[model samples]
Target: MNIIGGIFGIIFGYVLIRYRERIGGMLGDPAWAASIGGIYNVLIIVGIFIFLWSLTTMTGTSDFLFSPIINLFGGNTPPAPSDF
Candidate 1:
């Protein structure tokens, strides 16, 4: 399941990077077009992040990259038992 999800994520990220201009134009948002770096640039950055994350996940190395973030949000803590 993780491998499948990672593959799809990589493809999705590639699509976002490759067709960012078309996707942004289809959305037809003026703000998207008028941004400082442009919507395509934003999409490219997001796509790169997604691509790297998916690649790491596929290789089972995502833990190294994301452990700090997970720990920051307390994701590694065990759940408390119910009082009832």
Candidate 2:
């Protein structure tokens, strides 16, 4: 399941980066067209992030990448049992 989701993310990210102009036009936003540089840069960054993240996840190494952050926040502790 993780692999499937990662594959989809990679494809979506590639499409986003590859056809950003078409996507902006499809949104029908004049502001986007006028100030495309900023938006384009943002899209590129997001797309690249998604692609790399998916790649890591697909390889089952995302935990290595995220474990430090997770530990900083207290790690992956399970919820406490309810008293009921």
Candidate 3:
């Protein structure tokens, strides 16, 4: 759980730092970049669900433990990207 949260945080932070300009422009506030960072993590979780739903292979415990737990309760509430 901690590892997953850490990875999510790193990815979110990276997005905010890398695209601060364009994201800031779209949302009319520089802080929106930071906001969108959280959204990116949510999208990753949702995408993982969709991908897993389409497959039959057994997922490793590590993968399931991290992303699933984060999406279910570890991360932010009212998930960003407005898709939680």
| Residue pairs in candidate 3 whose N, alpha carbon or C atoms collide under 3 angstroms | none
Worst 10 residues of 2 by lDDT: 28-37
lDDT of 1 by residue, 1-84 (tens): 889999999999999999998997886656755565777777889899999998998999999889999999999999999999
- The sequence of per-residue lDDT tens digits that candidate 3 reaches over residues 31-61 is 4435656544444554455344323223335
28-73, model 2: which lDDT tens digit per residue?
Answer: 5456545655666667888999999999999999999999889889
lDDT of each: 0.88, 0.85, 0.51
Report the poorest 10 consecutive residues by lDDT, candidate 1. Answer: 27-36
**Runs of candidate 1 exceeding 4 Å displacement:** 29-36, 81-84
Model 1 clash count equals 0
Ranking by TM-score: 1, 2, 3
Q: Give each prediction's root-mean-square deviation over alpha carbons.
A: 2.3, 3.6, 14.0
Model 3 scores worst on lDDT over the 10 consecutive residues at 50-59
Top-scoring candidate (lDDT) = 1
Off by over 4 Å in 3: 29-84
